[model samples]
Target: MSDANWKVAAERDLMSLGGRPRLFESGSGSYVTDDAGREHLDFLGGIAVNSLGHAHPVFVSAVAEQAAKLAHVSNLFASQPQLDLAARLKRLAGTGEDGRVFLANAGSEANETALKLARLHGNPRGKTAILSLAGAFHGRSIGALSITPKAAYQDPFAPLLPDTRTIEPTLDALEHAFAADDVAAIFIEPIQGEAGVRELPDGFLARARELTRRHDALLILDEVQTGSGRTGEWFAFQLPGMLPDGELPDAVTFAKAVGAGFPLGGLITFGRASDLFAPGMHNSTFGGNPLASHVADRVLAHVEDEGLLANVTRRGAQLREAVSALPGVSGTRGAGLLIGIALERPIAADVVAHALDGGLIVNAPAPDTIRIAPAFTVGDPEIEDFIRRFGDALNAASQSSETTA
Candidate 1:
């Protein structure tokens, strides 16, 4: 099939999710092939969804085996896979003592679950206002959108969940928000993925922890893009620079790559927040099905067994340094494999288009910043190839912009 044929059918059959023009037919490891058989180095990794990259044998095998045995059972019953996945996550989250897991199908739902849990935790005290960072991207749902802080996404919806506020991600700003005394929870992303892979300052996050503790409010960390060893650590909050002395959030939401391309997301709640949800509060039918839970378990095992976190740390440093040295590149930021390269000029869209044409897949999350979330399994060779192609793409896009100007 031709790209044109797929695109035409997509336009007729699918709603606009604002996707790339090309159609990908298959993927393996760190590369994807389009309908025309052109291969592209997929640095985006399905927007940080394919943690183990494409067609990973372990993940494929686990999902296939589980499906053959038992695919799904409603939440009305208990399953070992679901309990096993929750146990693994609880250990990874460092919330084993007093933590529980609420399984959902995606990052947005996980966050939504967290929000509801926080509200429930604070309902007795009349603390219902939710605060988040100004440049965060939580999700597209009405409740998530309320805290997301993007007007373009929120304005069309008009009237989102009430009392959701976005404050600048600063200690002083956080202090001010906490002073209100009615805040139920503060939703923060340890590293804002859609906001150009921006990292919240270590000091700011620490201050948030302190303030939320003092105010008796829940500190919810959205690690949808930063968890599952994507940031060299099990969770970005666990990064030494962020919270070295084993400090943990009240609740942390994770999804994205957890299922290794299958949809899976949930939250790890600690202390009092763990018991917030009662029997009839909230639930999802297909949240922790055996197939997804088993695949997630395999992904977790693959990361630990292969020691991919160390690779992410090494490759991330190497790639950041290489990309920073390129012309038209300003600087780089982010932890581990989640990196953002700032351009000297606002031509990221053009650069992304050029990179795509040159068999690369990168994202322009901001007008002047390009975000790269390669799979944890990416290697030095893939990093080097991306740098070479990205440099060329940047130059081509820059020159084209200059000529047009």
Candidate 2:
């Protein structure tokens, strides 16, 4: 079908999330060709999912080979690829020998699994309350959304899973919440991506670890956006000073780049938490199918073999240093390639539109914050292109703002 026709049909049939969507035809490396045949740099990386960028040989080969060999076998059966992927994730997460994995199809499902774990851990002791920070975004599913704490996302789904509370992300607030000794689990994103890439305060995570340990509450880190080396390290919680030297969260949820554009997600439990879920507690038909598992295994292997984590660190620093000097940029936050550019004025949406017009792809997660999450494979050339195009967009936005003022 023609691109215009596709857009028309989408508008007629699809649910309205925002404005009309842009139709993208294909992609290679760090760029995508839109329906209009314009090659635009994909700095957003499908919201940080395309770790190796679009159509990488490793991703293509794994999908094809795995699909040809074997695909689905219900949870009643296990595949080698599934087992291998689970073992790899456990190692990367530093879950040691006791760690267990529950696979799912997306970030929301991964979080739902974690929520179930919380219930299992809390129910026996009559501790049923779940805690989350303000401005957090877990997922749209009812269980995940209950802890998300966003008004617009939660209001319509009134009468959500009760006993879910939103707290300010401060040690005092956290301490007070657990004072009742009825807290089940506390969900946190080491770096809250939907809240404009905001980072938790220094030492907050370590203190959380201490508190959750004292109260016997599960500390679940949502690495759905920051996992699989998007943040330079394998996981954001693994970053320096995120926690005490030998400490780890009770569970961690992962998705996004772990599949490198394919649909796969999971929750990894550490220590005694791994034994929380008994057999028959949860299952997914396509969660750990050979097709998705093999492809995800290959994506992670490619990231490790290619040293893309180092690339993410270096390229992210370069991009931040360059973009911070641009005309309208007030500052930059976030670690590695998951960057949020703060603007001097609330013109991030205007700047994003201008950037798209200039053949760059970015998005505004907030009125004054522009988010850029390019592929982990990004290097000098991509960084240079981003700086040039993004700078032009900033300049254009500045000019438009001045004219309006």
Candidate 3:
């Protein structure tokens, strides 16, 4: 097995849709070493899922210990870890004492549960239309995909959920959508991750809260990529000016970093929405298994005890400033570790490829935007390394562009 060629083995035994050439053999902190012995700075952080970074001692110990104690128990019977994780998330959400959590396997399932809750909550009021912003990417499941605004991803499965509509993320668009009085719920990402890490304009989210309340519509913040302390806060909606003064979202969805690489996601419902899911309304087999729940709990506890949120804030600003100062970068966007580099030209893909070749991991979510979500445990050294290598990658990309042109 040690001598097995990853590329050849992948091509032979796995699906072709999502294969990467380099086989990561080991990882720690902010770096991963490939089978070929190349150590790469990992800024992608498993697409923002590895909140604490690779092989953190706490994360490893929690999972191992939980697995030994009790890994799975049917939802019919509760586990301590599962219940504790729920309570912890609700507190972090700042929802009222009555707040409730519905656990699922990943972001998609969490959002699917939210959609169901929205439908159930809206049916009695005769409000059925689901509204989404034009640039939102909720998930890939049929229910979540129905609200996702990307036609390229949605068109393949045409004739999606009925009564679904999309509006731009502008005040005017919100006003226009609210005028109809038929919207049941509005799903949005505080920072559009896949659409190039674009932040929802300040005051716009607060205004959405006001409008949704005025219209008796549910405002659901999809914090899948921005939650669990990724944005220098437990949730993006918790950031100042995100919600109306002294107000909270109707519901919020979380995943990715919540489990810190383990498979766990959930929705926290506030106020009356918390009671929308009746008995047997929604459930998951592996949603809140003791192993995943315990791991997530440990991750969250460590996040607080170690003050990773403050670190995220500091590292984010440092990384963004450094990256934005690089050649070919026009600007930077996003908050905390969820940073995006706006390239001066439409060569994000080229930059990403060059960066990978230069032993730095990054991703191009849009033609002109390179996204980076390093681990919460990242330090000045890793950030510095990324900047140096990324600069070289950008130069390489520039050279390639000039040659091609």
Candidate 4:
């Protein structure tokens, strides 16, 4: 579609993420074109979904060829592409046994499926409560939303799904949750995304694994934002340097860049715990469809063939070091592509807008923090350019605020 056609978007629907009146026309590598044909060095990578950057020949061909061949086949049927993608995911996860995959359209639905699995797993043991970490975000559906933190997002939809609880302040909350009689699952992000890239405590994931085992509760890792090589490895939890013990979660939910700009999400589980749900228990109409899974296969294959994992490791460290060295940047958080730069104050939103004007695209996941999850394929030049442009944005933010005062 042409960029001039975007004005019609406002007239058609008022959905979110449209604040910028500017429209994007096309992209190549890590750069994008606005309606006016101004080029932008994109650093956000569509908020971590565009793993390979724009117009990667591999992704374009994968989607186009699959679309021309077969786009949709109901869940009742199986397609070769879908099966192959599932096998690849299982292999990446190192699930030696037949670890089943439940494909869906997006990350939220992915979490919903995992939540349902947990419920079914606990049904036999009479477990009902779902425990989630404070500042955690799973999804928006009542089922996924029930476990998500941030009352601002949840309060409006008060009286959400029942048997859900959030914990913060201390292990007391988690302990109380674990001790509860009706506990079923513990859903948590290995590294919190919207909550300032807040990482899970050291030895805590291992502890949660132990606690869930003790209570016979299922532990679901909401890796939607952290999985699929985003964190310099196949999964953040499995990243050797990130965690002290190098722990692994029972079940993992993935979406975002796993499909590399394709709309696909998946739920993976290990051991007998994954076999909780039987046929007819849960299904997605578009689940395991050809187009999405085919692109997913290509995304994984490209990541491996191009050795993007190692690239992410090197680039992520370089980016973090640069961010930490910035004037007002206080600290850097998150592993690999999922990075958050903490500012001294709430200048993140201002910096984001300024960055847009300075030919760089970034996002403010929190008021005082700027999040950067650029494409793993983004090279050294783009990384250096990003830091240079970002420094101007930060300086502009500081200067503008001073003038307003």
Write model 2 residue lDDT over 1-405, tens digit each, in one string: 686799789889989887755788899999999888889999999998999999999999999999899998787899999999999999999999999988899999999999999999999989999999998989999999999988899999888998999999888898899899999999999999999999998899999898898998999999999999999999999999899899999999999999999999999999989999888899898899889999999999888888889999998999999999887789999999999999999999999999999999999999999999999988889999999999999899989989999
Q: Ranking by lDDT, best first?
A: 2, 3, 1, 4
Task: State the lDDT of candidate 3 residue by residue for 1-405, as single tens digits.
Answer: 343666678789888978475788899998999877889999999999999889999999998899889999878889999889999999999986989998888999999999998899789999999999888999999989998988788999988899989999899988899898988999989999999999987689988888889999999999999999999999999888787667999899999998888988989999989878879878998888899899999999999999999999999999988888888899999999999899998998899899999999999999999999999988978988999999999999988999999
Colliding residue pairs in candidate 3: none
> How would you encode candidate 1's per-residue C-alpha lDDT over 220-300 as one tens digit per residue?
999999998889999988887676486778999999888889999998898888878889889999998888888898899
Worst 10 residues of 2 by lDDT: 16-25
Query: How high is the lDDT of residue 42 in model 1?
Result: 96
Model 4 Cα displacement at 23 (Å)? Answer: 0.9
The models' CA-based lDDT, in order, is 0.90, 0.93, 0.91, 0.85
Candidate 2 to truth, TM: 0.98
Q: Can you give the TM-score per candidate against the true fold?
A: 0.98, 0.98, 0.98, 0.95
193: Cα error in model 4, Å = 0.9
Say which candidate scores most in lDDT. 2
| Per-residue alpha-carbon lDDT of candidate 4 for residues 304-395, written as tens digits (9 for 90 to 100) | 99899999988999999988998999999999888989998888889988998898898988899998888989778998899899999999
